[model samples]
Target: MSILAIKHGIWKVAGEEVRQVKQVTLDSEFELEEIIQSNPAILQDNWLIIGRQVMTVYNTYIDLLAIDNNGSIIIIELKKHKTNREVVAQGLDYASWVKTLSPSQISTIYDDYVSRYYENQNTLEEEYYEKFRIQLEEESINNSHQIVIVASEMDSSTERIVEYLSDSLIPINVIFFTVFEENSTKFISRAWMIDPQETLENATNSVRDKEPWNGEYYVSFGDENNRSWIDALKYGFISGGGGEWYSRTLNQLSVGDRVWVNIPKVGYVGVGTVADTAKKADEVFFNDIDGEKKSIYKLSKNAKYHEEYLEDGINAEYIVKVNWLKAMTENNAASEIGFFGNQNTVCKPRASKWVHTVNRLKEIWQIK
Candidate 1:
């Protein structure tokens, strides 16, 4: 898409209106490359630049390589003019090589890159853990990779090729960056030809090689000091806090949905069905052993603080009532290596890792 800038100027004659449109140009491809390399977040957030002009076994070079928050590798190729017909094939070639890179090899690439260009001396392992908020395992890294084609414009054939690849569940997309100039000021805007998140979901589902979703969700019960697994089990609920960023996603869980609960840094603690949609803690009620329904604040002393935040508004801890099918204490929480646990409080994860985590939990808990 083209970026147009409208100019308003004094008319040469009365009652005459004149509008001028201006176009901006990049003097060289290096300008586009430098801006992206310096600020990768402009393309997407939480992306750690792994390498640039990185050479492969075939003696070809990749424009840029990055890793995202989900520990997936990103291959970014840029073009100043129309994307070439061979760009798609070149991207696939780089991806083929990238898929075989072990975690150590990826780290070495990042380390060498930093030593040559960056000021900080942090290792890739440290940055990976920091960016993703989880430790790195060699086998777990690069389970899937994505291709991003960035350019000023793309020909119809190139667009069709990319769309065809994506339709086949390949994680590839084109992002167009348009430039505009007015009064010696420059502006750049971005647009994605295909929805990136949708492509990612398609890619994730394709990689899992699993059936369609069974309508169950995986929810993490976070901030133990504010919500306890014991209390959640006793009250038949799950909770989240630390503001709307953490708690807002809880709204995605609806009544009648199945939920598998996990405690971060621990393991899967319980599996349950949602009995009620999410609400502020004070509004949450659960049936006690005596068959009496009471607000969770009365059942758990720690939950009382959630009531205080009710008046504070928006920052209050949110609760979703659950009908526990089976549960274990934090000490006995079932865990295995490579178990899936996202930092989000609630999510409908379709990744194979989530499926594996649930299968393992079922076997450990002996759920029929």
Candidate 2:
């Protein structure tokens, strides 16, 4: 693929334009690694860096190792002077060993890495919870792993291999990062050999093997400081941040859909049926004990603040009404060492961990 930039000139050359596109080489693989290390968010929002230059029992080194919000491991390999086949083989070799790692062993690896590179930072367990907003347990870690090959350029043979592997339902991919320089300004662009979301769906479907989706969904209530869980439970609703990025997922729920509610740092607190789809907070109303209906703002102080904030129109809280069937205070939230929770405010989870979480919650709440 070719990248081009159009340069605008002054009045003397009003109708003329200059196209300058220069391919730039990174000073070294170390520099490329430093750029990715400083901002793993560039790869994806869900990825949390575990360590750089991780070592395996086989005595080979992994370029970078990370974990996504769903507790799946991500192994990233950078291509320097090696042939495409060699780099791909090396990544696969690391993944073979990674797949065998038990959760406890993975944590140990992360701990050792932290001791070496981040001595003053929190322990691996603490950092895991802080980054993902959910507790990490040995059994819940590394259910599956993904392999990412990073290179400045990919040859046709490498691209073909990547496509074959991804189409075969293997969780492997290639991400090409091109550095370009124009007039002393530098820019980096990225492209994936296979669409990221499509690859994930294919991998997920292969794993599911035709298993039907459970009718339930998982929802993470926003942090307590912004939206009160007590208010949510008392008023029979759930809310997300005042931005569309946070609240748009709520649109996936419709009236009569059942959802499991979780509080970050806490656990699964309630199971409820959607009474209505998402709406602006100011538009929602709840019935009072006196049997009179009042706008949510009039009932909950938090709702009043949300309403006040929504007046600006830029960041307005969004709410989804729910009819709580089983509810508990944060102190009694239902969670075990292996229960599943995600950073997403609303998600329809189909992973085995989600199944385990729902089954356990059923026993705890005694719901049919």
The TM-score obtained by model 2 is 0.68
Q: Candidate 1's residue-wise lDDT over 1-368, tens digit each?
A: 21222222222233575554365777777788888888886787657888989989999888899987556789998864434667777888888899889888888889888988889978877878776556666655676789888876777788878778787778888777767676777666677778665455554454546455656687877635577777888778888865654677788787888889888778888998889888888777777778887877777775443565877557788888888889888888888887876655776666666777778777887875
Top TM-score model: 1
Positional deviation of 40 in candidate 1, in angstroms?
1.8
- Measured against the true structure, the TM-scores of the candidates, in listed sequence, are 0.71, 0.68
Tens-place lDDT per residue, model 2, 197-282, is 54443334336432445878889886555688888888899887555546767877899999999986688899999999888888
Question: Would you give me the overall lDDT of model 1?
Answer: 0.74
